[model samples]
Target: MQPPADLLLPDLDRTGAVPMLRQVYLALRAAILAGALPPGARLPSTRALGRQLGLARNTVVAAYDQLLAEGFVTGRVGAGTQVSRDLPEGLDAAAPPPPPAAPPAPAPDAAHRFRPDAAAHQPSALPFNTGRTSWDDRSQAVWRGLTLRRLARPDPALFGYGDPQGARPLREAIATHLRAARAVRCDPDQVVVTAGAQQAIDLVLRVLLEPGDAVWVEDPCYPALRAALAAARVRIVPVAVDGQGMDVAAGIAAAPAARLAYVTPSSQYPMGVVLSMARRLDLLAWARRAGAFLLEDDYDSEFRYAGRPLAALQGIDDAGRVIYVGTFSKVLFPGLRLGYAVLPPSLLEAVRAARLLVDWHPAGLAEGVVTDFLAEGHFAQHVRRMRLRYRAARDALVAALAEHAPALAAEPPDQGLKLLARLPAGMDDVALAAAAARRGVVARPVSPMFLAAPPVAALMLGFSGHEPAALRRAAWALGAVL
Candidate 1:
């Protein structure tokens, strides 16, 4: 019989990686599965098919043989290969049916803490996004050069499984940087290099917290913290954040017996407020009395445009109550996914076990690159240059808001990559943010950060990753959005 032009045989790639016969078999199997070739439909003889496809008769015959063996097609001496009616049905019957979709099996008591919005901080480019990090030509070239050098002279061990606590040299470098720059009280031995601050958060939750244990988290908090707390099945007690950061008094009044607490002490997230020394003392006292641990997420404390300087909570805690979390995402870039937790000596092995269970360890080659970056002092130099650029971006954004969108009150931050822009009272900040996003500005709503009713309507504007000119253009477009 004469063959048709289309075997719907996917175009044969004679020069491709896959063998010709296997490719042919796959194409014919796909056609059968897709119902393009109905049951009992006759295939042309191997010789005729070979001619149509420009393949040798042997290759076509071999392809047909595979399909026959797989039961997707049938062949007899007189009747040429034909599509099998029962193949797809039989395959489906062999596999188990899919389960119905349902909510995740978080502890029933902690279900209320798992709000959907907490997990919604996705990436957006340009004018304002908490997720992006600043980078210029100088920093990019340095990073590329360092990375290429590592790739060229790879350590054989990098290809093998890595240490769960991360590479020893990287941990030592991180400890050195934290001690000098952030006043963190830690040594290389106590440091557990994590994928990022989020994984560090998850590691702490796994190692220390038990299901249904009450935990203190800042109200209007960093969403990722809230989500992680909930996912770990801890009862998240929302402690109100005032000008002094997380209100320790409020947390005590609400959940004094809480097992653990999470705080961004150096600079409160979203609001960019520092924890006053008085409040920090009070928090440490509370943890001591309650015999609880504190997670001090030192988020975005690096770029202080003004102030005497912020100290890490972990640096001050002598009682070993603090688990200090810091990330290179803000300083380097979010894609690096490298962070470290300065754990208490007591929690070291437990955290290591939890890290092993979670993801084994952070990527090795990146760790190697960062170790050199810190050891050779490129990290400090890069941070210094990027500070000036980020400061300029912040100023430009604030200025643009003043010029075009005066109604939105912007609090240009003295620290951190983002600032809070208050919307008019009674206005919906979430709706305004959605509108701004449509106009290419990633304005995050401050109201959604709160667990309950928000006291104010505002947007969080990030400035670290933009050029001054780009920030101005985006802010003007955002004004148009307004």
Candidate 2:
């Protein structure tokens, strides 16, 4: 064995501008690279080196610590420190970087279809941004408390891998909440927790429909749902929406053999029309006869301004035809990204398996917090409080529209976040929306939302997420543009 003192380090430069620690580190690194200190050669202990160089022991130790971190040296108890047996390759400082190379193509599945769009990210405190919901201060404090409590508990499962089907306690709580509030027919075993309603929709599509297989979606439906379906590479059959909601008769006429139908029955997105009870029965009957499935997105059904929210389409579903999807994002907050699907016995395992294939499960910590919220009745309480706040904001928007822009036909929706305001006949809704955006408002044109029924010239203004004063101010600015 070579004695540690035989290692020849440079003389200490204590009087120079460079820190003694940095100089020590640089000297050792250079020695290792130049082969002055060969691989596996012993290094002097910090005390011995500091005494020889007349520097502090900490400076020498600091240099050795860096060398160890960078794989230039290794240390072990009793054996002391030595040069690394396997040193990491280092690039020559004068060498040029290699040329950029093209990436390989993605897999031939729906994975290739996804790309981020700004529409989901655009909802904000800005007036008329439809994807947001109003929040309260006290409720936020309560939510923070629940989250902290989850971390304080000493549970080993918190760090372990969780079930792909989601935590059983949270599923049980979600099942109970759905049964009581939306009248959904399911047990805890039937629910599969997901990142949000969007994931739940994607999972159902990939499992049930093949590429080019036809699926019926509501015209003027949620844009994100359409994006998911297109990403799955399935043929989307756009059915028109009437005052009664999705025209089921037109769908059957167009493609009765379609594998699935996605609808928001309780409150149609953007249009805000509840599916008539007669139509609901007819759709359910059609699904059973055709051996197809209906995905009921009960997204904002909890905050209806009318007497009470309507029962979910799943409640009336028999023959295992309905797959119910819902999210806690709206009532709690959007960032929570917690949503669930109540699957029929026929599709339970398939969806859970698809979930595993896509992403192994929702965050366990978030699941735990939601479970406590639902079981403690905090979820229901939060919904009740938000309903009143949203109603006030809705009223403000309606009054502002009528007062400021009378040419725009507007009506207050009974139970949804947005309202449809008809523009003057022959006016360009797209141009109008662009103008609104330039004026610091987010207005969505309704013409693009249509399937084929002569496009209606209208704009969709969201009301739930803005304050009354802010809504009024936005409406006044919107009037000037109109």
Candidate 3:
């Protein structure tokens, strides 16, 4: 009798670099991950699968045998091959519970401090959220490998409470990465590792600013910065940005008395503008004269698409005014939640104390893995590969928008992974974004990034996490919603 022909098989092209068995493994793994082939789904016989994929029966048998060894499949004489029913106990779907009821109100001071309105400050949706990276399996494999190696290490340091600042090796790795990739000059001792960039921001605010002290945050800047500063009781002064970058002259004029100025100069958040050399020098000079420090967030600067990447502000700060912040969230993965702050020699002790008072330090094992990953150059290689992939995705998004959404206009950015698309006059970006989300496309409104009042209506679309084809479909879907 003949075998059933409905079983799916992976089509492997000989021209690709991946091995055939690995491709087959990935195809089956992806099917499982997507729930396309549910647990206990029947698989085809090895002989039947061989014919479908144009491979020898032994090759098919070998692939299935490996799957069985990995506990991903099972077999019986009459039952044929089937996906494992056990599924490691957590693979099956489950329904989520409903939310709890509201509680009674509290006293006046308590109510004021614990107002429900605080929830409004939290981001409802993360459409086009900045600093997101592609979370593909290839990247996961690298991290997993690093984790396993770290687990095998016999050192007691791996299990102990890490230094409140960070692991020395990880700090050294960061110093090397920054100097090579960002042109920033700093010693390993100057790097203070934290949970992530947000934590670093909080630490900087706590250590540097007192209540009522003024700080300059870029107008239409990263909203979280405003919240962080507000939570620290620092008065925020908005400084506008132009094509060159943050308006340095305006920042000096508006907040000359401010103690610190936060700028995303490498690729300004929401706008994706690179700070030009002239403006960088001007801002550095202004900070020196105003006796203010510059908090330069160079997040996602590794993915520059245009000419040579710009040097970080810290590299050029002769006055010891730049507090440089960077994160592995974009370079590695966000879930790792590792970031570092490179402070001038003067601020090191204060920032270290704040970090110690907050969370003590980030995880030791994760930091060790990252240290190995960076030391071995895997992080650099991953960044290089993703940079090319992101450039392609960005171009695809641009072309698709131009073809499908003629009414929308995107300001081309010289660097960075995201860009702003201006809606035609009369269209409401906030409403349009709501409609887009319903269609499975996550696009954010540009208005909320602004301070006090919105200056324009636009959408911020991120291309780093998606492929070229997927980005095109997302853009088309967005157009249909509009």
- lDDT, candidate 3, 1-482, per-residue tens: 22335656556878859777777777777676556667778877777777788877887787788888988888889888888877854554554687797786655652332222232242322434445677566767988898887788745975667788999999999999899888899999999999988889888888888989999888787867777776676688988877787888887777787899999988787777768999999988888888889999988788888877788988988889999998888777777899999999999999998898889878998888889889998887888788888888788888889988878998557688888899998888888988887887777788767884456799988877766777777778888987
Q: Which ranges of candidate 3 are over 4 A from the true structure?
A: 1-131, 135-138, 452-454
Global lDDT for candidate 1?
Answer: 0.84
TM-score quality measure for candidate 3:
0.74
Which RMSD does model 2 reach against the true structure? 4.1
Per-model C-alpha RMSD: 6.0, 4.1, 15.4
Residue 111 miss distance in model 2 (angstroms)? 6.7
Give the top-scoring candidate (lDDT): 2
After superposition, candidate 2 runs with Cα above 4 Å error: 1-27, 30-45, 48-55, 65-93, 96-112, 115-117
lDDT of 3 at 29: 70
- TM-scores for all predictions: 0.81, 0.86, 0.74
What lDDT does candidate 2 reach at residue 194? 96
Quote model 2's TM-score.
0.86
Best-performing candidate as measured by TM-score? 2
RMSD of 3: 15.4
